[model samples]
Target: MLLHMFFPSKCVTCGSFGKVLCVSCKNSIKPVTQDSCIVCYRNSINGQTHEICKKTSFIDNALAIIKYTGAGRDWIGVIKYKRAYSTISEVVSIFPQSWIQKFKKITQYYTNALIVPIPLHKQREKARGFNQSKKIAKEFSKITNIPTSCVLLRVINTPQQAKQPTKNTRKENIKGAFILKQGQVVKNKTIILIDDLYTSGCTAQEAAKILKIAGAKTVLLFTLAHGKV
Candidate 1:
């Protein structure tokens, strides 16, 4: 990579040269074998919202792949903070094969579906140069055979979720941040919202609520990592 040439990388794990994460370190990041309720993080059927929890939930499921650790976290850190675009590919490459297959089966819920990347505020997106969620969704579409969309726009441009002062503040901050683009065709469709990370699930929830209100049959979420610091 051009960045690697400028400031060569060492493997985050084995300290090998020329890559932020070498092959061995990449192999060490384990897949999430068990799916759980995103709200409670306990075993559940396909990581869907449990009956008790769904009463107050917006998303049908929120499935995150690898744990936010090792090279996984390193990749996210580079992508989020360092603006290292090359690492985005590395992170997406590590999505487990098993999870991809599982996702295929789940999409059977809708004959018509869409992979909606969580959109960014226009100003922030212009500054960042790209929406990482959109990049992830594009690659995710390859395996899941789902078309990706930027229909969910963050019209509000609130403070960054990570910079929010508190969890409650986060919930409120993202409350009206998203609005479905006009004339989008999500009615009666299964919508899978994709993001780079799942922090408190507020952003996903808020986005899902708008989709549900817009008449999506089901709203599911998938993220590269759980922002479990």
Candidate 2:
């Protein structure tokens, strides 16, 4: 707490002192107005997987609070690369109350639900000092009263999805990258997968596939930012 007082907080967007995100920049961040299918990225109700698209993907539905642009992108970058962990709370603070209520309502539909964050490889996570997705998932769970779990582990240290040249390559790279932890049971439970960003979605898809294979009833992904596909 003393550290925070010594170097207070400044708005990431406008450099204003006091708040991590000033009111003006917070209001300026655009929310995803249209829900889309997780598999095809086409129009869908509540970001659910289209019935026809279900055969190709494991995720049941996906949701994101903000588009990955401008201040939203900056906010994620700070938390992810700069280690500005406090920014996570500030970002969550600005989430529209309507969105929070909708998320809470969604959780009500499942009797047994678990919040799971996309896990990073051990080395990467150790070097970074924390898993950004896990941190985000904790905050998410706090708001919704859902429990969080780390049932999936990253066994492969593949190249980053952003560096992959094509979507197919991204998918191939992430294939078989995750495995269920020994003795961890996800059978018959709904999973809410949390992540910092959604770009190609190869990472989330691969993680969800493993959970489904382990008998998870449903896997709903919730990301903080949605990047262009």
Candidate 3:
């Protein structure tokens, strides 16, 4: 009773006063059980790239644990803006265990896999105190035992993709925004690109392009949620 009076629980999605996420609302955030084409954003079998959707220049597979909305979106907002570390942990704990298995299958080619979080500009990271993507990657790394390498760097700080008016503009914004760090070795390796959200697919495509050009065997993108369907 005392705890309830001091810190009342409320549903982040519907504002139902009782819990951070009510049971019904929690069920609304469904885990993605199907594979999706990273480029076309369509349902895929076993997360495989549809032959027609395959392209030489971009990423192969895109994996998201949940569709962006309801509790999933609210949880990501908490991690990104509020920097609530506990909430982040809570959110990740609920991630479908199958997600880890799916990701491992995606990168099975490389004996040594490296996880890379989408980098943030130094200035923006300093202002935010911590990189949310990096945080997510680290937590995920703990769960999967895949080591995270801070190999990717944001050489060009660009505007946030969400603020862009169109998907094309978002792609243009981050076209040349990322590069690998000095002495980074991605050759013949599969890289798991981690991020908080997937919006226009622009950022993932750009980052994957750079990695593939630099000799990465395959680049797979995994985001916590997918925005804009």
Candidate 4:
């Protein structure tokens, strides 16, 4: 309370005084209404990978809360680069109630699910103070009561995907970037990979492939926002 009084929150968009994201700005940002296959970005039921797409993808299902545009993009940038961590919950709070319910149903269906944040290279994380994905995962677990795990390790310090110009380059850069931590058990469990944003999805894909190779029963991705393919 003292902290808030000293440094009051203000909307990242429109510069309103009060909340990190005001209700009006929150409502203006659109939510993803239709689920799409993560691999092909085509309409799919509950964001499941199309059976055909699954042959080439390791992630079984994926979901994102919003599109990466306008206010949505600004919101993510604030949380990511500006380190406005509180904005994460502010963003999630505005999600359509339907999306919240659907997410809960997914957790129920996958009873053996574990929320795993995409790991950051130790050097990067040390500089940033916290992993944005881990923060998002904590929010999800708080709502759903599922456990969170840091089972994946970033063994290679790769360039940020945003800097990679092409999808192929991004894929190549993230390849072999992650490995499961020694003695961590994901076998026969559903791994819910958490990330702040999804673009080419090379980062998530590489992490998911590692989980799948380790015998995870399924791999699902949940992100706060997604950029254009």
Predicted model with the maximum lDDT: 4
* Model 1 worst lDDT run, 10 consecutive residues: 4-13
Q: lDDT of all predictions, in order shown?
A: 0.80, 0.87, 0.77, 0.89
lDDT, candidate 1, at 10: 79
- Which model, 1 or 3, shows the larger lDDT? 1
- By lDDT, rank the candidates, best first: 4, 2, 1, 3
Name the weakest run of 10 consecutive residues (lDDT summed) in model 4. 2-11
Question: What is the alpha-carbon RMSD of candidate 3 to the true structure?
Answer: 3.7
* CA deviation > 4 Å runs, candidate 3: 1-28, 105-109
119-143 per-residue lDDT for model 4 (tens digits): 9999999988788999999988887
Superposition TM-score, candidate 3 onto the true structure: 0.85
Which candidate comes out best when scored by TM-score? 4
Candidate 2 or 4, higher TM-score? 4
Compute each candidate's TM-score over C-alphas.
Answer: 0.88, 0.91, 0.85, 0.92
Which residue runs does candidate 4 get wrong by more than 4 Å?
A: 1-10, 16-19
**Per-residue alpha-carbon lDDT of model 3 for 86-182, expressed as tens digits?**
5556666776667767656655655678889999999989987788888888876876678999898999889888888997889889989998889
Compared to the true structure, candidate 4 yields what TM-score? 0.92
